[model samples]
Target: MSTPDRLIEATRELLWERGYVGTSPKAIQQHAGAGQGSMYHHFAGKPDLALAAIRRTAEEMRETAGRVLDAPGSAYERISGYLLRERDVLRGCPVGRLTMDPEVVASDALRAPVAETITWLRERLATIVREGLDRGEFTPGIAPDDIAASIVATVQGGYVLARAAGSADAFDAGVRGLLTLLAPPAGTARHTDAVVSHHPAS
Candidate 1:
């Protein structure tokens, strides 16, 4: 890769692992095998480099979710696919992880992409729910915003649960529980015994 590309790749890895505050220009230079002078030649400084990395991460994440949410299927299929997409549940959201960082949250250079990525995701998920309601996939009373919020919450909380328990099983349980809620309402065959059992705990 070119010098700048190498630096951005290095920054991406560092940000995912160490977060914005923990990451340093010297560390990035070392990881990229570029000198301080070389890095500066490519970026004004650390913020410039970090903004590039953060935006790249956001765009990549959005692209991946767009694939799942925009796939060929009914809205239900696409939304569920987007929710259950493979992830390092313990590592949590690359962008959402910023909310926990004082430095990242305080910097518009870092925060804008993160905020936009999440906003886009929730809106996309909510739009799918709206479409599903239009197609009668859900009960009439089911609110699109509520369900969308739940879906986003489940994914976010699932990561926390997995991280707290130090097990993917915890994340699996969370997803199963959320998917159960997204199931069709009661007194119906769609309410499997297992799902019924999960409802009380959820």
Candidate 2:
């Protein structure tokens, strides 16, 4: 990788593993195998480089989510795909984890990408939920925005639960429970057998 790319990538990894306060310029330089002069030449300072790294991570999250959400499937199936998609559960979410860092939260410039990414995810989920309602895949009287917020909460909270227990069981269980709730009642126009069958064992 080029010097700039190396620096940003190193910052991204360190930020995820160590948080904003724990990662330092010297550490980033060493991790990237770039000297101090090179780092300074490529970026303004630590905060600037960290911003670039965070933005890149946020963009990646959006693209990954978009692929699943936009894939060809029933609304419920698309949502199920999102919830069941592979993730590094025990390590927690890269963008979501930043909300816990004091420095990251305190700085508006640093926090913008994290907040934007979350808002985007919630909005995207809400749109899918609306589609499901229109298609009769989900029961009526359910609020799309509310369901969207809950989905986001469940995933982020699941990560916390998994990390705390050092097991993915908690995360898996939460997802299963949510899917069960989301499944349409039996005898509906569309059967839920497919959805139930697709769920990963908890």
Candidate 3:
């Protein structure tokens, strides 16, 4: 990668692994194999580089999520794909993890990407949920926005639960539980079967 790209990529990894407070310019330089002169030549400082990195991370998150959410499937299936999508569970959600960092939360520049990514995900998911509701794939009583929020919570909270336990089982269980709740009444054997089949063993 070029100097600027290397710096941003390194910063992204550090921010995800170490958080804003834990990451340092020196550490970023070391990780990127770039010197202070090169870093400064490419970007202003830590916060500047961090914003670039966070924005990149947020963009990648949206793209990755959109693949599953926009794929051809029932709303439950599309959501199931998102929840069950491969992830470094122990490492946690890159953007969501930033919300826990006091420094990131304190600065609007640092927090904007994180907040925007989340809001975007919820809205995208809500759109899918509404589509499902219209097709009678889901119950009419449930609100799309509410279900979307719950799905986001489950994924983010699943990361926390998995990290705390030092295993991905909790994450798997959370997804399974949500899928169970989301499945339409058992009368539609195909729909129920598809949902059950997608869940990993708990």
| Weakest ten-residue segment in model 2 by summed lDDT | 187-196
Q: Could you estimate the TM-score for every candidate? A: 0.89, 0.94, 0.94
- Model 2 alpha-carbon miss at residue 169, Å: 0.8
Best-to-worst TM-score order: 3, 2, 1
- Candidate 2 contains a number of clashing pairs equal to 0
Q: List the global CA lDDT of all models.
A: 0.81, 0.91, 0.88
Clashing pairs in 3: none
How do the candidates rank by lDDT, highest first?
2, 3, 1
lDDT of 3 at 140: 75
After superposing all C-alphas onto the true structure, candidate 3 shows an RMSD in angstroms of 1.9
Candidate 2 per-residue lDDT, tens place, 56-122, comes to 9999999999999999988888888899888888889999999999999999999999999999999
The lDDT of model 2 is 0.91
- Superposed model 1: Cα runs more than 4 Å off: 185-202
lDDT of 1 by residue, 32-114 (tens): 99999999998999999999999999999999999999999767667667766778777878877877888889998789999
Poorly placed runs, candidate 2 (over 4 Å):
188-202
lDDT of 1: 0.81
Q: What residue pairs are clashing in model 2?
A: none
Highest lDDT scorer: 2
